[model samples]
Target: MIPLRALLYRRGTPVMTLLIITVNVLCFLFEMAQPFYLRESFIARYALIPDQPHALTFISSMFLHGSLLHILGNMWFLWVFGSHIEDAMGPAKFLLFYLISGIASAFVQFIVYFGSPIPTIGASGAIAGVMGAFLVLYPRVRVVTLIFVVIFVTTVDIPAAFMLIYWFAIQLLSGLGSLASISNAQGIAWFAHVGGFLAGILLIRLFREKRARYQYR
Candidate 1:
């Protein structure tokens, strides 16, 4: 299932969420503007390479996406779940939560894939954190989702808890499966998703403010 939007209403403008999306988009645009040869170098420089890890790449990697589909999916997930998280935590706290989640995610992936050469790039791990927080805060909220079943296609209003738990399960299972494989050519950072989600679940309470009135849609 693919989430189209959360059914919950917002308490205030999700200023930080929008700003983050803008930054990611701008970064992608800049990435595309580089010459083909230079682009490879640019991505490698900012991406988190577990074999040659850099201090800044943990943060920089979140804004770099490998392709159009990548950024679109990551940004869409962020918009669907992140706005409400930002509202619950406020702008400043939300920013910190996002960065912490991203860094945590990167660390987990680095540990798991130590000495691997593949570059990890994208906002997925950080966005997974937002989804995890949403599950904790609004499990009952319905997510309007796009579902594809065989040849048939449809939309469903899935409970946040169910949707998120299912997503997490997939990541956990995938991560475990990757460990048994010998190739270091894996594309997705499954462990990063898992770690970010767990971090979000653990950290949300610390960053979240007093309960706010739910603006249900």
Candidate 2:
């Protein structure tokens, strides 16, 4: 199921979410504009490689994308789920949550593949954190998802709680499978997704405001 949008709305502007999307898009455009080797070098410097881990890459790599499809997919989920999370936590706390969750994701990947030299790039981990927070803030909220089966296509509004749990399940199962498998064919950081999501679930309460003023107001 492809999520079209969340059926929930917030009163304030989701400035942080928009800022994040803009940054990711701009970074992708920068990556595209560079020459082949130059881009590779740039990604090499910023992308998080588990073996040669750096403090900055943990955050820098969140804004980088390997391809157009990659950026679009990550940004779409960020736009869909991030706004509500930012709304719930406010911009400052939201940004903190994103960075910490992303860092947690990088750490998870690093620990999982301790000696691997492969560089991991993308916003999937941080976005997964937003998804987790979205569930926490709006569990009963409905997500308008597009479902397509063969020639049949339709949209359905599924509860946020269920949809997010399902998503986490996929990430966890994939993570476990990655652990068991000898080959990492997809090169996807399933552990990062799981880590970010779990971090969000654990951190939302700490970041969320005690007396949030914008609940269905």
Candidate 3:
């Protein structure tokens, strides 16, 4: 099932969430504004490549996306979940958590791929970390999702635990398949998603403020 949104109430401003989205959009626009070859060169230079990983790319690459749909999906997930996370964790730490998660995600993907030359870009990895934090912070929350399979299509509300677990499983299986194929260029960096998620699960505590951990209402 494809998650639509979490069925929960959120108050206060999600300023950081909007800011991040704006920054991503601006970055994409900047990339697009350049000449074709310059754009290509820019992306290649900033994107995280496993064979020759650059320290800065670990963070820069998260803001880069290969296509429109890529950024849309990542931003959608971020909008759907990031607000509450930012509200719960507080905006400052939430931002820090996000950057750290992105770096960790790239690092993990680099380790898994080891020597692949394909450049990994996009915000999904960091978004996955937000998802991991969501799952841990609000596992009981329900998410309205679209269930689509072949000719079947429906919408339903599923518990966050189930949805996240399913999502993680898909990433793990796809990552394993990618490994077996020894190809990280099939489009999706599954392990990046996995690593970011795992980082969220483990690192969220350090980022979470002293406020009540469970703020669902």
Candidate 4:
């Protein structure tokens, strides 16, 4: 299911969410504007190389995208689920949550891959954390999702818990499959998604405010 938006009411402006999205978009544009050789150099320096991991790449890599479609997809997910998460946690805490989740995801991927040289880039892991927190904060909330089945296309309002759980299941299964595969081709960091999600689930309570002030729509 492709989640279009969350049905729950939002409280304050999602300033941090918008700021993060803006940063990602600007970074992608800057990356694309570089000449081929320079672009390669930029990615090589910023993108997290699991083998020769840098102190900064764990955070830097989250803002880099491999393609236009990649950035669009990640930003869409962030807008849908991240707004509410930021509303719940407020701006400052939400920012910290996002960074922590991204770093946690990088660590998980590094542990699994060990000395692999593949560069992992994108905001999927951090956004997965936001989705996880949404599941905990608003499980009963409905998410308007676009579903395609063969020749049929439709929209369905699924509970956040169900949708997020389904997503997590896919990530976990894909992660395991990647481990079993013998191919050396670069692939999605499925384990990073899993790690970020689990981290969000575990850390949401710590970051969430003691009082929820948002009004239900």
RMSD, each candidate, Å?
1.1, 1.7, 1.6, 1.2
| Ten residues in sequence with the least summed lDDT for candidate 3 | 208-217
Estimate the TM-score for candidate 1.
0.97
Q: Backbone clashes per model, in order?
A: 0, 0, 0, 0
Candidate 3's residue-wise lDDT over 1-217, tens digit each? 7678787777687999999999999998898888987888899899998898888999999999888888888999999888878877789998999998999899988998888888899999899999999888889999999998799999998999999999999999988887767863448999899999999999877877667345444
User: What tens-digit string does per-residue lDDT give for candidate 1 at 1-217?
Assistant: 8999989988878999999999999999999999998999999999999899999999999999989999999999999899999999899999999999999999998998989888999899999888888988999999999999999999999999999999999999989998888265368999999989999999999999887546778
TM-score rank order: 1, 4, 2, 3
Task: Estimate the overall C-alpha local distance difference test score of candidate 1.
Answer: 0.92
Instruction: Give the clashing residue pairs of candidate 2, or none.
Output: none
Error of 1 at 199 (Å): 0.6
lDDT of candidate 2 over 1-217, digit per residue (tens):
8898877668678999899889888889988999987988999999998889899999998989988989888988998888888877789999999999999988898888887778999999988988888878788878899889899999999988999999999988988887776245337889899999998988988999876533431
Best by lDDT: 1
Which candidate do you rate higher for lDDT, 3 or 4? Answer: 4
Candidate 1 residue pairs in backbone clash: none
The residue ranges of model 2 lying beyond 4 angstroms of the native Cα positions read 213-217
| TM-score of every candidate relative to the true structure | 0.97, 0.94, 0.94, 0.96
Displacement of residue 165 (Cα, Å) in model 1 is 0.3
lDDT of 4 by residue, 1-217 (tens): 7899888888878999999999999999999999987888799899888789898999999999999999999999999999999988899999999999999988898888888878889999899899889888888888999999999999999988899999999999989888876246457889889999999999999999998544554
Show the lowest summed lDDT stretch of 10 residues, model 1.
Answer: 178-187
Candidate models: Cα lDDT each: 0.92, 0.86, 0.88, 0.90
